[model samples]
Target: DELQAQKAAIQRETDLADESPEAQAIQEAKSEVDSNNKTSTTHIDSEKEPSAEEIAIAQTAVKAEARNHDLANPSASGEDTKSKSETETEKLAAAAKAKKDRINNNNEVASNTKNLMQEEAIKASNNSDVPNLVTNLNQSQASD
Candidate 1:
C-alpha cells in the first residue's frame, strides 16, 4: 500500500512537471489547427450555398424530369398501385384471422367455464345429505 501511494505521488509530480512551456507551445499549435479547421469549414459551407437562380433552375429541371418519368413508365406506376392494393388485401385477411382467433379463444374459455360449472353442480347434487338421511331413517324403521 505504501509503495502504491508513493508511485501515485510521483506520477502526480511528473504530470505537473510535464505541463511546462513546451507543452503550452504544443497546445497553442493545436489551437491554431482548430482555428484553421473552422475557417476551412466556413469556406466549404459558403461555396456550397446555392444562388437563387441556380435553385430555381434545379427545381424546374426536377419537376420536368419527374413529369417525363411518369409519362414514360405509366404501366410500372400502375403495377405499383396494384401491388399496394394486394398488400392491403393481404393485411385485411391477416387482421380477420387475428380477430377470428380471438373469438375462438373466447369461445373456448366460455365452454370450459360452462363445463366446470356443470361438473361442480353435479358434484354438489351427488354429495347432498338429505337423500342419505332419508334412506337411513327408512332402514331404521324397517329394522324396528
Candidate 2:
C-alpha cells in the first residue's frame, strides 16, 4: 500500500511539471485510453441522474412486475416476506387453524355430552332436593 502511494505521489509530481517527456507520454496514453473506452462501450447512458418522471416510470414498472406475480398466484394476497420453502409463518397459521378446529370439536363434544348425560332431565327430576332423590333410588331398588 505504501509503495503504491509513493509511486502515485512521484507520478503526480512528474505530471505537475508538464514540460517532462514522461509526463507528455503519460498524458497522450491517458487520452488514447479514454477515447478507446468511449468507442468500445456504446451501451452506457450519458445521463448521470434520472429525472422525476423517469424515476416514477421505473417504479411503476417494478410495481407492475410484482402485480403480475400476484395475478398469477391468487393465494399470495399480501406482501411476500419469504419463499414457499421458508414456511415458518405458514406453519404457525396451520397450527392455529388446527387449534381452532380442535376447539370446535371440543365444543361439539361438550354439546353431545349434554345429551349423553341427560343432565337437564336429571336436574329437572331432582328439583334441587337431595333427600328425595335418595329415597326415590332406595324405593326403586327395593321394588326391583
- Top candidate on TM-score is 1
Question: Which stretches of model 1 miss by more than 4 angstroms?
Answer: 46-144
- Score every model by TM-score: 0.26, 0.21
Model 1: per-residue Cα lDDT over 1-144, one tens digit each: 999999999999879876988878888999999988887855556557788999999999998988877856657674466677788999999999998787667988767766777743334456545554345546667578
Deviation of model 2 at 99, angstroms: 0.5
Whole-model lDDT per candidate: 0.78, 0.78
Candidate 2 residue lDDT tens string, 1-144: 999999999998866788788779988999999999888847757877888999999999988998877765767655765777669878989999998787667978767766787755433464565454344546667578
Go through the candidates in order and give the clash count of each. 0, 0
lDDT of 2 at 76: 69
Task: Check candidate 1 and list the clashing pairs.
Answer: none
